[model samples]
Target: YNKYFSLGISVADEMFGLLFFVLMAHTAYGDVSYSFLEEMKRGSVIGNIAKDLVLDVNRLSSRKARIDTEGNRKRYCDINLNTGELTVAERIDREEICEKKSSCVINQELVLENPLGLHRVIFNIEDINDNSPQFKQSVIKFEIRESALKGSRYLLDEAHDADISMNAVQSYMLQENEHFLLRVLTRTNGRTYGELVLNKELDREQQKEVTLILTAVDGGTPPRSGTVAIHVTVLDANDNAPLILPSCLIPGCVHIGYNITITATDEGSPPLSSTKNIHLTVADVNDNPPVFQEQSYRAHVQENNKPGSSICSVSATDPDWRQNGTVV
Candidate 1:
């Protein structure tokens, strides 16, 4: 028995052009599925099988049935006189996807049957980025330690001004470090830094200091420049000791506890002159024999029967400077 279903229609340029009729059924056991009896085929006609039935002329049958002939075995559906239902011979939606103009289907309108159902199908498309990275500010500056080695990583004060996707921001470039020895360290948020690490350590005696410049770039379709200047100041290490100058300028004139002025200076940056203004204290040494104030003194100790008893103590003082003045 044929069952009635819904219809779908679409129009273009203010005229109805596309129409689809879908048919679904409840079998004898009450299970809902589509029927495959009648479909769109050539020469198949959708007319009332029972002519004397009391149904409306145009409402009796939907022309969605199968054409049933040997050479013209196209599918078409006939109008149900009792139920006003359409019967399809093949799958409804797959048969009616025509891209041409003025194309029509006889019984293939079942494609739009479940257009609003949750089981409807759809397609999605995606887009990509193609723009290169640039710098927000033309120039940026940061400090670098002169002691930093070539190829050592120095963080940038500015970051790239583009979205961080492979198509948008491809890779990074450096204007300097041409030896291909420089390396880059990137942060999680796309910030980048370069290293000028040392191929060999520097000697303070040969070259006291130096300076360097740095720049950054990104890899895109058309690359962008993000250049920055790095100012590095190499400081001197205290490798040289203080040297005493004009050793013989004073001759045996120092007295006990008298502070003498001896000059000592280091041959380094700033103030290469001798450290003459600095005073050096001189203490009297044991050059002369120790003279007793009272010639000699006598001490008496009583004999003790018990052990661990103190007998007598004496002390002396020397008027010298540094470690020499104190005795252990």
Candidate 2:
């Protein structure tokens, strides 16, 4: 049966171009597998299915040889009757089809009529380095006390890649610096993550903040990577005691009856302080004398004024409120 089919196909190929076919199938003709890179262009030739399955190319037109994806709504591939070649009907993006699966394979069936036959065809969609590792956030922040111990580990946001296997994120790199370093860890589930380790103690007064870059990289050739900025804020810790100076000068206006409070604080994380209150009361001193309204006092009386006769009155003024400025 195979020999006769091949002979007919050869003659048809020499005459009219092999064109068009229908499918009839109940008999299984075994499975055929082909490997292809992901993201193949539409209309790209995959393989000659008729040749692989030892089918009659001539019978394709009369018997109707076609492809079926088990009632799939989107057909990814098609069979060309003229050349018996299987080709991509639409673009095949492995990431869209299989997501994070370790391996991606598309199953299809090649069917033909006449005697009726079914051949299983498998397409192994290999991964390509088309995706870069990505973090959920652009920046990560941390707060540590100035007294924080060295070798402290801070978990970081894990990077994700759409592509799997060698194309997925495999390692991490932290920008070189004295205060921190990067540590890559693998989970029991075969997944990887990153940690930031503190290599030195922080001093809030000397250096209050630090920034570093963390990068996630894949193992693909000409690797791709994503980065996130790490910001660390060093909090203060109580480390110094309050000190009192021998003497201090008071500022601003002060009166004899005024009260004042003095506070002293230390430059510590949580500062220490002391306070003192003062009150004052003293006797007043006379500083001004009374003044007459006219520099020289002049009074006039009638030519033969009698004793105790009334004369022009003399007046004096005092500026002080108390007896210190009184005129007698």
Candidate 3:
């Protein structure tokens, strides 16, 4: 029986095009594991295997099964010359290599010269508790309305860890706050996030501001953790009724001259309402009366003056303006 695995790569470029394919497989097992995060030297033994039924361990076939890394990834391991055991070729940083991926494997091609056969081996890099969780920012700020009801959930930024599996971020903890609690939401992709839930109503006049501490811990011996500072500000709510300003000042009587604009304001978050246009009307008060410029007027005209002859005109002034200032 023959067992075979194939890898196909298609590349397209404006000036060039290339298609690549390679095949690799193990004689018995398909995958293997190695402890990562440790300082691996250039020739540290990782595993042992036989080549062409030569398991004597004296005359090994390491040269026949030379190690070859794929693409641009630096070679991390190679087989020993006399022992025929896989050895570390270069230092491997699991965090930098895998990042957010769950399945982290190293691909290598082992080519034998005598029979001219190529075999691929997948080395699964097992994670260790080497990295701590980290948040994108040092401080997070949340602005909420004072009228927000209880049981409201606010989404929060998630913490990230370079490690994977049990070594990755496991849980989140929020510092005890009287009006707020913390919740962790797990997604379909096995990702977790932090959420701040309101336990009671917020009052801007009573407590305008609050601070919380969020911590993320990983599942490891002597677990490592990270923290983020959370600051929440309660916004004002519309609670006061509209207030009309005390009347406008008048010099003489501006009612007939110009229109007065009175303002109505409130003590809410938006202090002013849309109804800022006020129609100020001057009420009619029967008080001051218009008086003529002179108490008496004497007009001297020639005898037998023309029917439509000109005569002296009288003018009057009133202290009150607008409707009260009207004089005939």
| Every candidate's lDDT | 0.38, 0.80, 0.72
Stronger candidate by TM-score (1 vs 3): 3
Q: Please provide, for model 2 over 1-328, each residue's C-alpha lDDT reduced to its tens digit, 9 standing for 90 to 100.
A: 2322465476686432222131212444467999998778989998998898787787788778888775464677899888899898998888998998888888887766676667777899999999999999989999988888999999999999998877889999999998998889998877799888889988888998999999999999989999999999999887545554535444333465677677888776467787777564444456557888988867766798889987877778786546866788
Question: Please, what's the RMSD in Å of model 2?
Answer: 12.9
Each candidate's clash count: 38, 6, 1
Regions of candidate 3 where Cα sits further than 4 Å from its true position: 1-43, 51-65, 112-118, 238-328
Q: Residues 1-328, candidate 1, lDDT per residue (tens digit)?
A: 1112222322243222222122222111121223221124533333333232222435323432222322233433433445444343343332132212122223222211122111111111111222234445544443433344555544444444433343334334554432223456766865565554445545556654444445555554455544454444445655555766644433343643544565566656543434444344443444443334555667676776468666555555554444645644
**Candidate 2 lDDT score at position 63:** 74
Error of 1 at 214 (Å): 3.1
lDDT of 3 by residue, 203-228 (tens): 88899999999999998888999999
TM-score of each: 0.29, 0.67, 0.58
Q: Which has the higher lDDT value, candidate number 2 or candidate number 3?
A: 2
Candidate ordering by TM-score (highest first): 2, 3, 1
The candidate scoring highest on TM-score is: 2
- Model 1 lDDT vs. the true structure? 0.38
Which segments of candidate 2 are over 4 A away from where they belong?
A: 1-26, 243-328
